[model samples]
Target: MTEQFGLFDARGLQPADAAAPPLCVRESRRARRLTLRVLPPHTLELVVPHGARAADVAAFVHRHRRWIERARREIASHYSLAQDRLPTRIALRAIDQSWLVRYESEPQAPPRVRVLGDELEVRTRDASNRGADAALRAWLCDQASYHLTPWVLREADLVGRRPSRVQVRLQRTRWGSCSSSGTLSLNAALMFLAPAVVRYLLIHELCHLISLNHSQRFWDAVERFEPNYEALDRQLTEAWADIPVWAHPDARRR
Candidate 1:
Protein backbone atom coordinates (compact mmCIF):
# COMPACT_ATOMS: atom_id res chain seq x y z
CA MET A 1 0.00 0.00 0.00
CA THR A 2 1.31 3.49 -0.93
CA GLU A 3 0.61 6.79 0.80
CA GLN A 4 -0.82 9.72 -1.16
CA PHE A 5 -0.35 13.39 -0.34
CA GLY A 6 -0.28 16.74 -2.09
CA LEU A 7 2.88 18.83 -1.94
CA PHE A 8 2.24 22.53 -1.32
CA ASP A 9 4.80 25.27 -1.53
CA ALA A 10 5.41 28.84 -2.70
CA ARG A 11 5.54 27.44 -6.26
CA GLY A 12 2.20 25.59 -5.82
CA LEU A 13 1.34 21.88 -5.58
CA GLN A 14 2.91 18.50 -6.39
CA PRO A 15 2.15 14.82 -5.97
CA ALA A 16 3.58 13.13 -2.87
CA ASP A 17 2.81 9.43 -2.93
CA ALA A 18 5.07 6.83 -1.36
CA ALA A 19 3.36 4.32 -3.68
CA ALA A 20 2.07 5.45 -7.05
CA PRO A 21 1.47 3.85 -10.48
CA PRO A 22 3.75 3.69 -13.49
CA LEU A 23 3.06 6.70 -15.68
CA CYS A 24 5.04 8.47 -18.39
CA VAL A 25 6.90 11.36 -16.74
CA ARG A 26 7.65 14.50 -18.75
CA GLU A 27 10.19 17.09 -17.61
CA SER A 28 10.94 19.68 -20.37
CA ARG A 29 7.90 21.17 -22.12
CA ARG A 30 8.49 24.35 -24.13
CA ALA A 31 11.54 23.07 -26.00
CA ARG A 32 12.17 19.64 -27.43
CA ARG A 33 13.52 18.41 -24.11
CA LEU A 34 12.24 15.88 -21.62
CA THR A 35 14.12 14.10 -18.83
CA LEU A 36 13.47 12.44 -15.50
CA ARG A 37 15.65 12.67 -12.43
CA VAL A 38 14.84 10.34 -9.57
CA LEU A 39 15.37 12.27 -6.35
CA PRO A 40 16.04 9.19 -4.25
CA PRO A 41 13.97 8.15 -1.23
CA HIS A 42 10.90 8.79 -3.40
CA THR A 43 10.71 11.86 -5.62
CA LEU A 44 11.17 12.53 -9.31
CA GLU A 45 12.81 15.72 -10.54
CA LEU A 46 10.97 16.23 -13.79
CA VAL A 47 12.40 18.82 -16.15
CA VAL A 48 9.76 19.91 -18.61
CA PRO A 49 10.35 21.86 -21.77
CA HIS A 50 9.08 25.43 -21.46
CA GLY A 51 5.37 26.15 -20.95
CA ALA A 52 4.67 22.83 -19.23
CA ARG A 53 1.91 22.50 -16.65
CA ALA A 54 2.66 21.38 -13.10
CA ALA A 55 -0.68 19.61 -12.93
CA ASP A 56 0.35 17.32 -15.79
CA VAL A 57 3.74 16.61 -14.17
CA ALA A 58 2.18 15.89 -10.82
CA ALA A 59 -0.29 13.56 -12.43
CA PHE A 60 2.55 11.75 -14.15
CA VAL A 61 4.38 11.31 -10.84
CA HIS A 62 1.22 10.03 -9.15
CA ARG A 63 0.80 7.46 -11.91
CA HIS A 64 4.25 5.92 -11.35
CA ARG A 65 4.41 5.97 -7.55
CA ARG A 66 5.52 2.51 -6.41
CA TRP A 67 8.12 1.85 -9.10
CA ILE A 68 9.72 5.28 -8.68
CA GLU A 69 9.93 4.99 -4.95
CA ARG A 70 11.43 1.53 -5.12
CA ALA A 71 14.16 2.68 -7.45
CA ARG A 72 14.84 5.99 -5.71
CA ARG A 73 14.88 4.53 -2.21
CA GLU A 74 17.91 2.40 -2.94
CA ILE A 75 19.75 5.31 -4.50
CA ALA A 76 18.96 7.58 -1.59
CA SER A 77 20.25 5.08 0.93
CA HIS A 78 23.64 5.12 -0.80
CA TYR A 79 24.11 8.87 -1.18
CA SER A 80 21.78 10.96 0.93
CA LEU A 81 23.13 12.80 3.95
CA ALA A 82 21.39 14.05 7.04
CA GLN A 83 20.58 17.76 7.44
CA ASP A 84 23.18 18.22 10.15
CA ARG A 85 26.48 17.04 8.72
CA LEU A 86 29.94 17.40 10.15
CA PRO A 87 32.80 19.17 8.43
CA THR A 88 35.85 17.18 7.26
CA ARG A 89 38.93 19.19 8.00
CA ILE A 90 42.57 18.77 6.97
CA ALA A 91 45.43 20.38 8.89
CA LEU A 92 47.71 22.53 6.75
CA ARG A 93 50.54 24.99 7.30
CA ALA A 94 50.03 28.50 5.99
CA ILE A 95 52.78 30.64 4.51
CA ASP A 96 52.63 33.16 7.37
CA GLN A 97 54.10 30.62 9.80
CA SER A 98 50.62 29.63 10.90
CA TRP A 99 48.67 26.38 10.87
CA LEU A 100 45.18 25.97 9.42
CA VAL A 101 42.69 23.43 8.18
CA ARG A 102 40.16 23.55 5.34
CA TYR A 103 36.75 21.98 5.59
CA GLU A 104 33.60 21.43 3.52
CA SER A 105 30.09 21.51 4.91
CA GLU A 106 27.20 19.45 3.65
CA PRO A 107 23.93 21.34 3.00
CA GLN A 108 26.39 24.18 2.74
CA ALA A 109 25.68 27.80 3.60
CA PRO A 110 25.74 29.81 0.36
CA PRO A 111 28.99 30.40 -1.48
CA ARG A 112 31.47 32.14 0.78
CA VAL A 113 35.09 31.97 1.92
CA ARG A 114 36.07 32.72 5.46
CA VAL A 115 39.03 32.43 7.79
CA LEU A 116 37.62 31.72 11.22
CA GLY A 117 40.66 32.86 13.10
CA ASP A 118 42.88 29.99 11.85
CA GLU A 119 40.43 27.76 9.99
CA LEU A 120 39.94 28.19 6.25
CA GLU A 121 36.25 27.79 5.54
CA VAL A 122 35.02 26.63 2.14
CA ARG A 123 31.28 26.81 2.57
CA THR A 124 29.03 25.37 -0.13
CA ARG A 125 25.27 25.88 -0.15
CA ASP A 126 24.67 22.21 -0.90
CA ALA A 127 27.50 19.73 -0.85
CA SER A 128 24.97 17.28 -2.27
CA ASN A 129 24.19 19.62 -5.18
CA ARG A 130 25.90 20.86 -8.32
CA GLY A 131 27.44 24.19 -7.31
CA ALA A 132 29.70 23.04 -4.45
CA ASP A 133 32.66 22.05 -6.60
CA ALA A 134 32.39 25.11 -8.80
CA ALA A 135 32.07 27.51 -5.87
CA LEU A 136 35.11 25.99 -4.16
CA ARG A 137 36.99 26.12 -7.44
CA ALA A 138 36.30 29.83 -7.88
CA TRP A 139 37.31 30.65 -4.32
CA LEU A 140 40.48 28.63 -4.66
CA CYS A 141 41.44 30.37 -7.89
CA ASP A 142 40.97 33.71 -6.20
CA GLN A 143 43.10 32.53 -3.32
CA ALA A 144 45.73 31.16 -5.65
CA SER A 145 45.87 34.41 -7.60
CA TYR A 146 46.29 36.38 -4.43
CA HIS A 147 48.87 34.10 -2.80
CA LEU A 148 50.72 32.49 -5.71
CA THR A 149 50.80 35.30 -8.29
CA PRO A 150 53.53 37.39 -6.68
CA TRP A 151 55.69 34.33 -6.23
CA VAL A 152 55.00 33.06 -9.76
CA LEU A 153 55.76 36.47 -11.31
CA ARG A 154 58.94 36.88 -9.35
CA GLU A 155 60.15 33.47 -10.46
CA ALA A 156 59.09 34.13 -14.06
CA ASP A 157 61.13 37.31 -14.03
CA LEU A 158 64.08 35.61 -12.42
CA VAL A 159 63.94 32.80 -14.97
CA GLY A 160 63.49 35.35 -17.77
CA ARG A 161 60.22 33.70 -18.86
CA ARG A 162 56.77 35.27 -19.11
CA PRO A 163 53.47 33.41 -18.72
CA SER A 164 50.54 34.24 -20.95
CA ARG A 165 47.74 33.34 -18.54
CA VAL A 166 46.83 31.63 -15.31
CA GLN A 167 43.72 29.47 -15.02
CA VAL A 168 42.33 27.38 -12.17
CA ARG A 169 39.96 24.44 -12.17
CA LEU A 170 38.60 21.46 -10.18
CA GLN A 171 40.96 18.78 -11.39
CA ARG A 172 40.48 15.30 -10.01
CA THR A 173 43.40 14.25 -12.17
CA ARG A 174 46.52 16.40 -12.17
CA TRP A 175 48.12 19.31 -10.44
CA GLY A 176 49.42 22.32 -12.44
CA SER A 177 49.96 22.40 -16.19
CA CYS A 178 51.80 24.70 -18.59
CA SER A 179 50.84 24.98 -22.23
CA SER A 180 52.98 25.92 -25.18
CA SER A 181 51.01 29.18 -25.29
CA GLY A 182 52.62 30.38 -22.07
CA THR A 183 49.36 29.63 -20.25
CA LEU A 184 49.39 28.01 -16.81
CA SER A 185 46.58 26.15 -15.07
CA LEU A 186 46.56 25.08 -11.45
CA ASN A 187 44.34 22.78 -9.47
CA ALA A 188 42.04 24.71 -7.14
CA ALA A 189 42.34 21.85 -4.64
CA LEU A 190 45.84 23.09 -3.96
CA MET A 191 44.27 25.67 -1.68
CA PHE A 192 43.74 22.83 0.82
CA LEU A 193 47.43 21.97 0.68
CA ALA A 194 50.35 23.13 2.76
CA PRO A 195 51.71 26.47 1.59
CA ALA A 196 55.11 24.90 0.95
CA VAL A 197 53.62 22.32 -1.41
CA VAL A 198 51.57 25.08 -3.05
CA ARG A 199 54.74 27.11 -3.56
CA TYR A 200 56.56 24.10 -4.96
CA LEU A 201 53.73 23.42 -7.44
CA LEU A 202 53.84 27.02 -8.53
CA ILE A 203 57.55 26.85 -9.18
CA HIS A 204 56.98 23.56 -11.02
CA GLU A 205 54.50 25.27 -13.35
CA LEU A 206 56.76 28.28 -13.87
CA CYS A 207 59.56 25.89 -14.71
CA HIS A 208 57.29 24.48 -17.39
CA LEU A 209 57.23 27.98 -18.87
CA ILE A 210 60.65 26.83 -20.14
CA SER A 211 60.37 23.07 -20.58
CA LEU A 212 56.93 21.97 -21.68
CA ASN A 213 57.85 18.34 -21.19
CA HIS A 214 59.21 16.71 -18.07
CA SER A 215 62.79 15.78 -18.77
CA GLN A 216 66.20 15.90 -17.18
CA ARG A 217 66.37 19.50 -18.33
CA PHE A 218 63.19 20.29 -16.43
CA TRP A 219 64.47 18.54 -13.29
CA ASP A 220 67.67 20.51 -13.53
CA ALA A 221 65.69 23.71 -13.91
CA VAL A 222 63.48 22.82 -10.94
CA GLU A 223 66.46 21.96 -8.80
CA ARG A 224 68.26 25.11 -9.92
CA PHE A 225 65.40 27.30 -8.72
CA GLU A 226 64.29 25.34 -5.66
CA PRO A 227 67.02 23.16 -4.29
CA ASN A 228 65.71 20.21 -2.24
CA TYR A 229 62.83 20.15 -4.71
CA GLU A 230 63.09 16.38 -5.01
CA ALA A 231 62.04 15.95 -1.40
CA LEU A 232 59.24 18.50 -1.85
CA ASP A 233 58.03 16.71 -4.96
CA ARG A 234 57.91 13.45 -3.04
CA GLN A 235 55.91 15.12 -0.31
CA LEU A 236 53.49 16.57 -2.83
CA THR A 237 53.02 13.17 -4.43
CA GLU A 238 52.32 11.55 -1.07
CA ALA A 239 49.87 14.28 -0.13
CA TRP A 240 47.48 13.21 -2.92
CA ALA A 241 45.50 11.12 -0.44
CA ASP A 242 44.79 14.25 1.61
CA ILE A 243 41.73 14.52 -0.61
CA PRO A 244 39.71 11.53 0.49
CA VAL A 245 38.15 10.96 -2.91
CA TRP A 246 41.43 10.57 -4.75
CA ALA A 247 42.46 6.92 -4.88
CA HIS A 248 46.20 7.10 -4.47
CA PRO A 249 47.99 3.79 -4.91
CA ASP A 250 50.26 4.44 -1.94
CA ALA A 251 47.45 5.68 0.29
CA ARG A 252 46.91 2.19 1.74
CA ARG A 253 50.50 1.97 2.95
CA ARG A 254 50.00 4.92 5.25
Candidate 2:
Protein backbone atom coordinates (compact mmCIF):
# COMPACT_ATOMS: atom_id res chain seq x y z
CA MET A 1 0.00 0.00 0.00
CA THR A 2 1.08 3.60 -0.62
CA GLU A 3 2.48 5.43 2.40
CA GLN A 4 0.43 8.09 4.08
CA PHE A 5 1.38 10.83 6.51
CA GLY A 6 -0.29 13.27 8.87
CA LEU A 7 0.47 16.16 11.18
CA PHE A 8 0.31 15.32 14.87
CA ASP A 9 -1.79 17.51 17.10
CA ALA A 10 -3.04 17.23 20.64
CA ARG A 11 -4.51 19.17 23.52
CA GLY A 12 -2.11 21.45 25.46
CA LEU A 13 0.38 21.47 22.56
CA GLN A 14 1.49 25.08 22.15
CA PRO A 15 1.72 26.76 18.78
CA ALA A 16 4.91 28.56 19.86
CA ASP A 17 6.60 25.29 20.83
CA ALA A 18 8.85 23.37 18.49
CA ALA A 19 6.84 21.26 16.06
CA ALA A 20 7.30 17.52 15.77
CA PRO A 21 8.83 15.99 12.65
CA PRO A 22 6.55 14.79 9.89
CA LEU A 23 5.06 11.34 10.55
CA CYS A 24 5.12 8.68 7.85
CA VAL A 25 2.22 6.28 8.30
CA ARG A 26 2.39 2.90 6.67
CA GLU A 27 -0.37 0.32 6.79
CA SER A 28 0.80 -3.26 6.74
CA ARG A 29 -1.41 -6.29 6.71
CA ARG A 30 1.46 -8.34 8.02
CA ALA A 31 2.04 -6.08 10.99
CA ARG A 32 0.43 -7.57 14.03
CA ARG A 33 1.16 -4.53 16.13
CA LEU A 34 2.03 -0.85 15.87
CA THR A 35 5.72 -0.07 15.78
CA LEU A 36 7.76 3.10 15.69
CA ARG A 37 11.00 3.48 13.81
CA VAL A 38 13.11 6.53 14.56
CA LEU A 39 15.58 6.52 11.70
CA PRO A 40 18.77 8.48 11.25
CA PRO A 41 18.67 12.16 10.23
CA HIS A 42 15.40 12.43 12.21
CA THR A 43 12.75 10.58 10.23
CA LEU A 44 9.79 9.18 12.17
CA GLU A 45 7.98 6.21 10.70
CA LEU A 46 4.91 4.51 12.14
CA VAL A 47 3.86 1.08 10.98
CA VAL A 48 0.28 0.25 11.85
CA PRO A 49 -1.70 -2.89 11.31
CA HIS A 50 -4.39 -2.54 8.72
CA GLY A 51 -7.46 -0.65 10.07
CA ALA A 52 -5.52 1.26 12.74
CA ARG A 53 -6.76 4.73 13.56
CA ALA A 54 -4.99 8.04 13.15
CA ALA A 55 -5.78 8.92 16.76
CA ASP A 56 -4.21 5.65 17.88
CA VAL A 57 -1.04 6.42 15.96
CA ALA A 58 -0.93 10.01 17.23
CA ALA A 59 -1.47 8.82 20.77
CA PHE A 60 1.30 6.26 20.41
CA VAL A 61 3.72 8.87 19.19
CA HIS A 62 2.61 11.26 21.85
CA ARG A 63 3.14 8.74 24.63
CA HIS A 64 6.61 8.02 23.28
CA ARG A 65 7.64 11.63 22.72
CA ARG A 66 10.29 11.54 25.42
CA TRP A 67 11.67 8.25 24.11
CA ILE A 68 11.78 9.65 20.61
CA GLU A 69 13.67 12.71 21.79
CA ARG A 70 16.21 10.51 23.56
CA ALA A 71 16.57 8.27 20.52
CA ARG A 72 17.15 11.23 18.23
CA ARG A 73 19.76 12.58 20.60
CA GLU A 74 21.52 9.21 20.62
CA ILE A 75 21.56 9.10 16.84
CA ALA A 76 22.85 12.67 16.64
CA SER A 77 25.61 11.87 19.07
CA HIS A 78 26.77 8.94 16.93
CA TYR A 79 26.47 10.56 13.50
CA SER A 80 27.16 13.89 11.83
CA LEU A 81 27.04 14.34 8.09
CA ALA A 82 30.01 16.70 8.31
CA GLN A 83 32.07 13.77 9.52
CA ASP A 84 30.40 11.39 7.05
CA ARG A 85 31.51 12.96 3.79
CA LEU A 86 32.71 10.71 1.00
CA PRO A 87 35.96 9.01 1.91
CA THR A 88 39.22 9.02 -0.08
CA ARG A 89 39.70 5.35 0.72
CA ILE A 90 37.28 2.54 1.65
CA ALA A 91 38.20 -0.92 2.84
CA LEU A 92 35.94 -3.95 2.67
CA ARG A 93 37.33 -6.48 5.11
CA ALA A 94 34.60 -8.93 4.13
CA ILE A 95 35.89 -9.08 0.56
CA ASP A 96 39.54 -8.37 1.31
CA GLN A 97 39.54 -5.37 -1.00
CA SER A 98 40.07 -1.66 -0.69
CA TRP A 99 39.43 1.19 -3.05
CA LEU A 100 41.26 4.46 -3.53
CA VAL A 101 38.62 6.98 -4.47
CA ARG A 102 39.30 10.02 -6.66
CA TYR A 103 36.88 12.65 -7.80
CA GLU A 104 37.74 14.61 -10.95
CA SER A 105 35.71 17.39 -12.47
CA GLU A 106 36.06 19.01 -15.89
CA PRO A 107 33.97 21.58 -17.69
CA GLN A 108 31.28 19.99 -19.87
CA ALA A 109 32.55 16.51 -19.06
CA PRO A 110 29.95 13.77 -19.00
CA PRO A 111 29.62 12.00 -15.67
CA ARG A 112 31.41 8.67 -15.63
CA VAL A 113 32.78 6.08 -13.21
CA ARG A 114 35.71 3.70 -13.56
CA VAL A 115 37.15 1.12 -11.16
CA LEU A 116 40.65 -0.04 -11.90
CA GLY A 117 42.81 -2.15 -9.58
CA ASP A 118 42.34 -0.62 -6.15
CA GLU A 119 41.15 2.71 -7.58
CA LEU A 120 37.65 4.02 -8.10
CA GLU A 121 37.53 7.23 -10.12
CA VAL A 122 34.50 9.37 -10.86
CA ARG A 123 34.51 12.13 -13.45
CA THR A 124 31.70 14.64 -13.61
CA ARG A 125 31.09 18.23 -14.63
CA ASP A 126 29.47 18.88 -11.27
CA ALA A 127 31.78 17.87 -8.44
CA SER A 128 29.08 18.08 -5.78
CA ASN A 129 28.71 15.63 -2.92
CA ARG A 130 25.45 14.31 -4.37
CA GLY A 131 26.99 13.52 -7.73
CA ALA A 132 30.04 11.91 -6.21
CA ASP A 133 27.96 9.91 -3.75
CA ALA A 134 25.75 8.58 -6.53
CA ALA A 135 28.70 7.55 -8.65
CA LEU A 136 30.40 5.84 -5.73
CA ARG A 137 27.21 3.97 -4.82
CA ALA A 138 26.91 2.63 -8.37
CA TRP A 139 30.43 1.34 -8.18
CA LEU A 140 29.81 -0.25 -4.79
CA CYS A 141 26.78 -2.09 -6.20
CA ASP A 142 28.87 -3.43 -9.06
CA GLN A 143 31.51 -4.63 -6.64
CA ALA A 144 28.88 -6.21 -4.40
CA SER A 145 27.33 -7.99 -7.33
CA TYR A 146 30.61 -9.32 -8.61
CA HIS A 147 31.75 -10.49 -5.19
CA LEU A 148 28.60 -11.43 -3.29
CA THR A 149 26.93 -13.40 -6.09
CA PRO A 150 29.71 -15.94 -6.52
CA TRP A 151 30.30 -16.27 -2.78
CA VAL A 152 26.63 -16.99 -2.10
CA LEU A 153 26.42 -19.51 -4.95
CA ARG A 154 29.52 -21.34 -3.81
CA GLU A 155 28.30 -21.52 -0.24
CA ALA A 156 24.88 -22.71 -1.36
CA ASP A 157 26.51 -25.46 -3.39
CA LEU A 158 28.54 -26.65 -0.41
CA VAL A 159 25.31 -26.80 1.62
CA GLY A 160 23.62 -28.77 -1.18
CA ARG A 161 21.07 -26.00 -1.73
CA ARG A 162 20.53 -23.75 -4.72
CA PRO A 163 18.69 -20.53 -5.22
CA SER A 164 16.83 -19.80 -8.41
CA ARG A 165 18.64 -16.47 -8.73
CA VAL A 166 20.55 -13.89 -6.71
CA GLN A 167 20.13 -10.15 -6.80
CA VAL A 168 22.18 -7.44 -5.09
CA ARG A 169 20.63 -4.19 -4.02
CA LEU A 170 20.88 -1.47 -1.41
CA GLN A 171 18.58 -2.53 1.41
CA ARG A 172 17.78 -0.90 4.72
CA THR A 173 17.32 -3.07 7.82
CA ARG A 174 18.00 -6.48 6.26
CA TRP A 175 21.06 -8.50 5.24
CA GLY A 176 19.28 -10.85 2.85
CA SER A 177 16.09 -12.73 2.09
CA CYS A 178 15.22 -15.95 0.30
CA SER A 179 11.86 -16.24 -1.40
CA SER A 180 9.80 -19.40 -1.60
CA SER A 181 10.72 -19.62 -5.25
CA GLY A 182 14.35 -19.99 -4.08
CA THR A 183 15.38 -16.57 -5.36
CA LEU A 184 17.75 -14.88 -2.94
CA SER A 185 18.14 -11.14 -2.62
CA LEU A 186 21.22 -9.91 -0.77
CA ASN A 187 21.88 -6.47 0.58
CA ALA A 188 24.85 -4.89 -1.15
CA ALA A 189 25.78 -3.47 2.24
CA LEU A 190 27.01 -6.94 3.13
CA MET A 191 30.24 -5.71 1.58
CA PHE A 192 30.72 -3.65 4.76
CA LEU A 193 30.43 -6.62 7.10
CA ALA A 194 33.27 -8.82 8.30
CA PRO A 195 34.17 -11.96 6.35
CA ALA A 196 32.81 -14.31 9.01
CA VAL A 197 29.73 -12.16 9.37
CA VAL A 198 29.22 -12.30 5.61
CA ARG A 199 29.51 -16.06 5.62
CA TYR A 200 27.01 -16.31 8.46
CA LEU A 201 24.60 -14.15 6.48
CA LEU A 202 24.93 -16.41 3.47
CA ILE A 203 24.32 -19.47 5.61
CA HIS A 204 21.37 -17.77 7.26
CA GLU A 205 19.79 -17.16 3.88
CA LEU A 206 20.71 -20.55 2.53
CA CYS A 207 18.94 -22.25 5.40
CA HIS A 208 15.82 -20.40 4.41
CA LEU A 209 15.78 -22.54 1.30
CA ILE A 210 14.86 -25.44 3.57
CA SER A 211 12.58 -23.46 5.89
CA LEU A 212 11.31 -20.14 4.64
CA ASN A 213 10.49 -19.04 8.16
CA HIS A 214 12.89 -18.64 11.05
CA SER A 215 11.69 -21.77 12.84
CA GLN A 216 13.70 -24.08 15.09
CA ARG A 217 14.58 -26.19 12.09
CA PHE A 218 16.04 -23.19 10.32
CA TRP A 219 18.19 -22.33 13.34
CA ASP A 220 19.42 -25.92 13.47
CA ALA A 221 20.40 -25.75 9.80
CA VAL A 222 22.20 -22.44 10.26
CA GLU A 223 24.08 -23.73 13.30
CA ARG A 224 25.06 -26.84 11.37
CA PHE A 225 26.75 -24.67 8.74
CA GLU A 226 28.10 -21.89 10.98
CA PRO A 227 28.48 -22.62 14.67
CA ASN A 228 29.25 -18.95 15.36
CA TYR A 229 26.01 -17.74 13.83
CA GLU A 230 24.62 -16.25 17.03
CA ALA A 231 27.49 -13.87 17.62
CA LEU A 232 27.54 -12.84 13.99
CA ASP A 233 23.77 -12.29 14.06
CA ARG A 234 24.19 -9.84 16.93
CA GLN A 235 26.92 -8.03 15.05
CA LEU A 236 24.72 -7.53 12.00
CA THR A 237 22.40 -5.25 13.97
CA GLU A 238 25.27 -2.90 14.83
CA ALA A 239 26.95 -3.09 11.44
CA TRP A 240 24.96 -0.24 9.89
CA ALA A 241 26.87 2.33 11.90
CA ASP A 242 30.15 0.96 10.57
CA ILE A 243 29.09 1.59 6.98
CA PRO A 244 30.36 4.92 5.65
CA VAL A 245 27.51 7.42 5.51
CA TRP A 246 28.13 8.14 1.83
CA ALA A 247 27.19 4.56 1.04
CA HIS A 248 23.73 5.01 2.51
CA PRO A 249 21.88 7.98 1.05
CA ASP A 250 19.60 8.30 4.08
CA ALA A 251 22.55 8.54 6.47
CA ARG A 252 24.26 11.13 4.24
CA ARG A 253 21.33 13.54 4.54
CA ARG A 254 21.60 15.70 7.62
Best by TM-score: 2
Q: What does the lDDT read for residue 173 in candidate 1?
A: 32
lDDT, candidate 1, at 138: 53
**lDDT of candidate 2 over 135-209, digit per residue (tens):** 777777888999999999999997789999999988643567777788888888889889998888889888888
Clash pairs, candidate 2, are none
Q: Across residues 15-74, which tens digit of lDDT does each residue of candidate 1 receive?
A: 243123112233221335434555322234444454445566566556665655766555
TM-score of 1: 0.50
lDDT of 2 at 197: 88
lDDT (C-alpha, whole model) for all candidates: 0.53, 0.69
What's the CA error at residue 53 for candidate 2, in Å?
17
CA lDDT, candidate 1, residue 176 = 69
